[model samples]
Target chain A: MTSPTPAILPERGLADRLTALFWRHPRLLLAVLLTPPLLWLGVVYLGSLFALLLQSFYSIDEFSGVVKEEFTLKTYAELFRAQNLDIIIRTLVMSAAVTIGCALIAFPIAYYAARFARGKWKAVFYLGVMLPLWSSYLVKVYAWKLILAKEGIITWAAEGVGLSMILNAILAIPGIGGNSLSTSPLGTFIVFVYVWLPYMILPMQAALERVPTSMLEASADLGASRAQTFRTVILPLAMPGVIAGSIFTFSLTMGDYIIPQIVGTSARFIGLAVYQLQGTAGNIPLAAAFAVVPIVIMLIYLTIAKRKGAFDAL
Target chain B: MTAAVEFLRVSRHFGPASAPVKAVDGVDLTIAEGSFFAMLGPSGSGKTTCLRLISGFEKPTSGTIRIFGQDVGDIPPNRRNVNTVFQDYALFPHMNVRDNVGYGLMVKGVDRRTRDARAEEMLALVKLEGYGDRKPAQLSGGQRQRVALARALVNEPKVLLLDEPLGALDLKLREAMQDELKALQSRLGITFVFVTHDQGEALSMADSLAVFNEGRIAQIGTPAEVYARPRTRFVADFVGSSNVLPPEVTRAFGGPMKWASLRPEMLRVTAADGVALAGTVTGIRYLGAGSRLSVALNGTEVAALLPAGQPVPEPGATVGLAFDPAALHVMEGEG
Candidate 1:
């Protein structure tokens, strides 16, 4: 019925009382605010990574098609072989090309949407750019396959328009052949660039949107030409977005196996290699080792991008 | 002096023919060289649009704009010898104060040494000498504004366009910056085209002012001329506080009018025996320097400002007021 007795303790100062208060409401303190990310990093991301690293240490026997229990770096050692290294290098080059291509195309589109387009058209144009992103990525790549095939709509239309001879001649030149675009690595690269273009565009649009139109006006007012405004003010302000979008395009292209498997005849990417080693050969250790190549490349990319303030664009 | 900037029959419209919004409708104005000019209006009254046209942020739908005697119809904004301090300042957040102020020079291919020295000089002029290394975000509002001014001024354009540059600051800071801007404009001897919706801002800083209404120039004059003799009801009501009276002119002295406007301070509160109208005090507001009393005179509300030490009329007390005839402006109602 009466109030509970107050706890008696040694006399303490304001600092000690403040610490005690913090301890009492620890949920209102630090840990509650930090728990979500801590759990994600500790349990999901790092745990899965630890498991993958452990698997990479096991050796795969060629004839038996079984993983050895004993710890070994043989799988990783095998990854440095000429064939595997070629796949790794090809992936890097293709990813870089796609990222650069996307950046080039996206910059103008984003600039137009941010600065020139007015009222409802701005939203409509941006939505058109983003609509492909919501659709299935696989479907979009598959659609490109049909368009690039030998008897595809594009080739038929080119022939119907009497430009097929010119197109065929260009395609027949040494490195580029008369064979269908679907049968070449260039086909895979084109599809990769097309499918992931929106990823680059949306972020660039967001970044360009953050740039005040006044800044561009200010640039022009200072006697800089339209070209100069783009180069100086617009380009510098949109750099963060460019880098951010590049990261997405580069990493996504590096790790994608589906487009290459469907559209390419001879091109072999690290992602396709990983899929082959795991799915067909039943060599989990080797596949895991191949996964490390993309992970390492992405880590290097992230470090460079972070240093350039790309994350601030988020 | 030659006109530093001039707009001849300039008109700008947006959207399709079925529904076009005329942002600037046939405005003809001439800004004198080395003078600070202000375009004042309420929002959507085309003040900012007019500034944009002069600054080359926008081109006229039809007509010509001349800067320092050059007809700049085909010349793009960048090629124009004008710079603008945008309403939001638009300082590059990624660049430090030095780089931001130096950007215009850098784009012109100036050497780093020359650009940096000039940028530092401008930074000092704006009283931001030590702040050259700080980013725009790191500086306070007033500091950012100064940096924006320095950036615009470093280009040494013949005309400087400011779009409500002091609108973002708090009251005290705004007043200080207003004076600073006026003094800066005078010292540089460069023509300034400033746009603001605040009447006080226009009256204080402008050497001459243009009042815009519905995308048209309503009137243009020096501050005192505009304040003393507004040509329209809108001008009289907008430029300052005035007691607009709706009166049937049973007797007329100069012009035809159904209403007249009188400045509150021009009305002398008097005893009931010697005044034209009888009124009862409705309310009183005590300002530090002066007190204002609201009176109901002939079924219309009239406000009069009195000295602070004057005796306050009670709310129900009967009172009389008289206004100087010279200070009264007769105006026609909106047709």
Candidate 2:
């Protein structure tokens, strides 16, 4: 003991230190790091889904006006009923038409912004396009409703400008017009597309902007013309963005209840049908079953989108 | 051969007239066919702008650019019979090597078989034959550079514009590639109008060179002509390291004499005294193959390069430096 005792170093092994760290304040660390997200995913998302799924399995007795917990395939069976299937098909067609229309319109605007527009003007132009997004979604949809109505400003202005006859002729085209602008399925489809067009354009503009200007110059230097550069260089690079925008338009059109509720009269979409089932008829199970249809369609869309590198764009 | 590229009194003014920045001001150049011509300058010296004007990327505000005797003022970059290898290489990242090389052929509506064969031939010429399927990201920087070369050369333009092609490579690789590029240009027999800020690159690879200063071509001559007898102080200072001593002409030295410029390598260090300036060695840098001495003579610094194993004077030691009168270049004051 008198011969100068050798100092011993403390052995703090990795596992031992980690164990001690966790043991000190296990609940506190868990709450700090994991509780907020766990509560959000577990309670908000999963709790609602658990109730909805439970409702999907139950049967509602129309005569007794009482809900029964007896699980059956009848609600799912009713989802494929002819009238319901028609609504599903109509929603898909409307979403496809809107996506195509948006892509055609947004491509040139995005290309011009990314390639030609310089300085503050590019930011101003992009901000102008995105300015519509900040406005209330309901107000925009309602504004469109007034514009397209028979006695609204657009029709009155068309008549005042002596373009009423031309407007009527254009509206009466086969598959597009049945009778008049306000009371047709095409009218509702147009309204839906107008409301959701911004969602498609923003993502597309972002994707197209990622293509370096040097790549385009390289293409031109290689003797490609303007049209050829667009086809070969511009289109392929913007594919991932286009697919992403399409997914947004498709899923939103499928799930949206308000737009179709306001504009649709003759042509009923699955979203409107689901709303009627849940709210008007009190057929929660049938509505839940119909909800599963759009989810399935969305899943298929997401799968294809993932395969085409759409997820990477996001 | 006739001039493959010519810019006559070309001036390009950007922005408003009141305070216009003349990127290239009144430049007149004629690049001989099949010659490796280098335009050397620092950043914003208008060398690149001149190249862009010739390549039809930018139009001259007041003058004309002709490619192979035809006016290219109204023509676009793709329409001009000249291709540019941009400083960044500008290879299409989405495309494979073969597609990138054959882009010009494909755009011209050549048959796929012929285009593919031509692409392969170009790839082989660049020694990148097996890298056809690989993207630009997969290749190393040097390999990517070669791919860029193959892509530009495959187009077979009347003139190829290289904007600092070797500026991105490491020192050793750049030197090797410089030799390769010189050999390639000769083999292809295509006129190359290269732009670079590197004096060594210009001197090593160029058949003739133009030194640009403040939006003007200060001097243009062959590498030897320019180096041996620089007309302007800017040219002498830019092209090589020089000890510009303020020496008054004690005697009339007739042939185009102005201020004296003595290149560091031209100054020989010797112990023998007569007909030489005496200076104290302020510093000595023993650079393995050779030694560089910083000598102070009359409060002015003069650098002298001496071969290794030659006795180098220590700091504060007196040394005699001598150079041939022919080696002392007379140059005009800086423009």
Task: Write the residue-wise lDDT of candidate 2 on A193-278 in tens digits.
Answer: 67677777777778888887777877888888999998888887887778877878888888887877766465677788788889
Candidate 2 has a TM-score of 0.87
Q: Give chain B TM-scores in order.
A: 0.94, 0.94
Model 1 steric clash pairs? A220-B78, A223-B78
Weakest ten-residue segment in model 2 chain A by summed lDDT: A305-314
Residue pairs in collision within model 2: none
lDDT of 2: 0.83
lDDT of 1 by residue, B1-335 (tens): 89998999999998896887999999999999999999999999998998888877777999899988999988877778788998899887767889899989988999999999999999999998888888888888899999999999998989999998998999999999999999998999999999999999999999999999999988899999888877677887888877766554312323345567677788778888866666899998998898898988767788889887778788889988876678777664341
**Model 2, B1-335: lDDT tens per residue?**
79998889999999999999999899999999999999999999999988888776678899888888998888888888788888889887778899889999999999989999999999999899889999888899999999999999888998999998888999999999999989999999999999999998999999999999989999999999888888777787888877665544312222243566778898888773774477899998888999889988767888899988887777889888877778777676565
- Return the top candidate by lDDT: 1
